[model samples]
Target chain A: MPDTLSEATRSEFDRDTSVRLREPGVHDADLSPGWAIGHALNGGYLLAVLGRALGKTLPHPDPFTVTAHYLSATAAGPAVVRSETARAGRTLSTGTASLFQTGADGEEAERIRVLATYGDLGALGDDVRTSAKPPIMPPREQCFSAQDYPAGPDATPEISKRLDLRLDPATCGWAVGAPSGRGEMRGWLGLADGRDADPLSLLMAVDALPPTAFELGLSGWVPTVELTVHVRARPAPGPLRVCVTTANLAGGFLEEDVQIWDSADRLVTQSRQLARAKLD
Target chain B: MPDTLSEATRSEFDRDTSVRLREPGVHDADLSPGWAIGHALNGGYLLAVLGRALGKTLPHPDPFTVTAHYLSATAAGPAVVRSETARAGRTLSTGTASLFQTGADGEEAERIRVLATYGDLGALGDDVRTSAKPPIMPPREQCFSAQDYPAGPDATPEISKRLDLRLDPATCGWAVGAPSGRGEMRGWLGLADGRDADPLSLLMAVDALPPTAFELGLSGWVPTVELTVHVRARPAPGPLRVCVTTANLAGGFLEEDVQIWDSADRLVTQSRQLARAKLD
Candidate 1:
């Protein structure tokens, strides 16, 4: 691992996404309240908890790609992840997981369904070289920090308090109810607790910022229906630059596309998620 | 149902994506040669096959979104789809499937893994409206049809025979060794069997075009590693406009983004896929 794998990265992230084996294919996890927006937990954090179960059950060590479907919003608490391997190839292993939680109706509800593939990413491919250009943004110091956002009563969304997320001030109009109508968001993201982000934590980073559609006048936390994440190269621990943009928002449905550039300025991750949000 | 659901749509599509229920969660499907490209079945067509199994095993009527990870390429032959429903509620249903085929080593191999959600699309949203702009292209009459491409020894790709896929002539340089290096493809798509395209067929349509990276001078078929399709609305029966583009290609990997516009000029389907291809 890179020297940047600080003690904080290991302990804090493990605390956030760690899972304990219950049976051969089942694991138990505690969804931390520190990762919730309002009452619902972040979708990417949920996927990481599920990823932990899959990463342990499968033969591979790193996740190559993962797709998660949010069946229903889940609250933070004890959850069970039922994971099973679908394929165990020489270099790649595939698995499916479902996180179940007890609902208000006293029913065991499966909150999220995830399909992921794992592999030894180091041996997967060559060095990074991309024709894509990095997202343009002001210096981190000049950007509007989510931490400093004026919180009226809600206590700065518990989730934001856990991350060092700085949004481009030009794109921060939505926070003030003056949306720019541009379906995009650019930010610098890292763990506020000094935990460096690894490939697994980058899963959470993809969704760390406010929804890009929020800039288009959509309010509240737009629920993600389905999200697909592709991890190309693991980042050398540090803050990751992120760009989230959307082109289609029709009939209260839209898709958000994300790109995460590592400290070396190479594209390291990409994701597209379908979500539900209403216009202002 | 729309009058566009002609007998051809029902019969031809059923023949192509049909799955015979073997049990509650298992289905047997015949891999159709008509849907193969140089013996490798088209990724979108394969996704349609998996969607067929999940659509039947689950309670819902329409597939809202599906993400498929292509583990290994399978040739045309007998295959089994082992599908299991993870969640089945009133409004939505989720399921996972593995399409297994006999490999050259005489062992059954899981060719692909698919995760999908189903719901009643008709009741899902409102009328058509979009902020996305349709892809620019010349009139259909001036474009180059995949069927008319010059065949060298091998018959025109078997899969192209199955659809009326037209490519914008300006972007066709990749076909004759003079690539445009733009990494984009614009075209019109429709079923050659005269079958109308519904929301289900849009799954296949998303991956129906030649890999857009071809314009960037990448040769041969770019194998898709993972593909996610979001179906926003049921498309009307007609030739659909499609735009396929990629901005990031590094470490021998790239992500393709596609948008499909319906007859009414409304965005109907969107997809993002990670594929592997080598530059010439």
Candidate 2:
């Protein structure tokens, strides 16, 4: 019994973000190094974990579109995922995956719920192509490390260590108490561990940037009510350039749009999320 | 037995768009009067039906955020809905609902899959409020009926009858064989059935507008890959003022953002979707 228990713990700790199917429709995942904003795990990290689980259950290999609703803040630890196939078609497959934290009584408490679509982008051939100019920014060598800025009042220091973000100085006005008078933020994003940018990493990049609402003179925790991401193309091997913008802020709600361009200058991922402003 | 079967058929034909739950986690719905584009049922109408089913399964009555991925074009017929509760929190509940068409062999073929979040929007309390000006548009009386324009090569007449749309003439350049040079469409929208605008109606309204890509001189069917709608508030009882805009159209893909305002001039729903441009 002791040997079996030790083996299970070692396996859980080894693959923190990877999905391992424990049985059909059930998965075991570990959230290590624990990306958190205060005590709550980062929403994107939880999404990536769930995405991996959904991808495994579907026939396709790429998650072309994914949407998540954060039911509650989750703590970092061993989590369980249960996925069910909603539809399986010739070109696309859709499903839902739920993440849970087990209690001492063996009860599972839900954290985040996601709906995702998996497809083969290559199968959906691109028949029409036009160039939408990417956002302009200084070269990577000229940008400043985003780590220099202090964490948000609700953020933890581990965020900087988990994701390496370098900001365009001109758009970093919010860091110095001066906003650009526009809700926008541009930066270069990559994993701090120097891993290649994949679909999961791009998901994290979509929410990793500083909230665009911060530039509108708003502060504190801006919780995302819902987030939707569209993966256009597989990213090339390099840092991704990201631009986040919010055009409307009203009714205590704001919508943030993010565009991620790969090193090859190809638009890889596009995401938009609606969130509530935590203002006193 | 004959009378029972006849009564079921009458009930199914009478309320095609209304949601009627047959049991916990299961629902019986019809697709009569079939909201169709040529032969396929409209995606938004399907979403509304699925959203209604999910709302019934959750503790909350309002579905504030809903997303749908159209797996395959569906036909008008009897359908079954299976909903699973993913998370039932104190303030919000997230779940998945799958719609299927029952075949002659009693096989259920999945048609549409949805992820939805239900909450007590009124209970959330309006603590923060700021106004964002609604889109600029000519009065409803001044705008022309979109029906006068010929349906797109890919559009069907059912769209015209499903929603009464009045377009701002200046933005309808495509209707007269001229490109607007900008990716935008502004108009007023309301149900053809004259039903009051509720949260479910607003979900349909988000996708009711003409494809913004048409204004950019792109023609044919621009199919939505995925759509995400965020319900900010319960809309007032009147035609909704709407604006749909796309800033980037590249590589056969475009993202459209929509803002919906009610009769009281308050922003009620915001939506964003990614779609493929079927240019000839």
Using DockQ as the measure, the top candidate is: 1
Question: On residues B209-269, what C-alpha lDDT tens digit does candidate 1 reach at each position?
Answer: 9888888887877988889998888887788998998887766778888899988787888
For lDDT, the strongest prediction is: 1
lDDT of model 1 at position B206: 94
Candidate 2 lDDT tens digits, B1-280: 1212344343322245665668789988777555776676777777888887788788888877888877666778788889988778787777888889876688877777788878776765554343457888899989978446766434545766767789888888888888687888889998766766888777777777678888888877887768888887888898999888886676577888888989987788888887778765
What C-alpha lDDT, on a 0 to 100 scale, does residue A237 get in candidate 1?
A: 76
Interface RMSD measured for model 2:
3.7
> What residue pairs are clashing in model 1?
none
Q: What is the DockQ of each candidate?
A: 0.58, 0.37
Q: Chain A alone, TM-score for each of the models? A: 0.93, 0.88
lDDT of 2 by residue, A1-280 (tens): 1212244443321244676778998988877655766666777777888887888889987888899888776777788899988778777788888889887688887778888888886665544343456889998778767446656523434666676688888877877888776778899988876777888667777888778877777877899888899888878998999998886665566778888999988888889887877654
* Model 2: fraction of the reference interface contacts it also forms: 0.42
Using TM-score, give the best candidate's number.
1
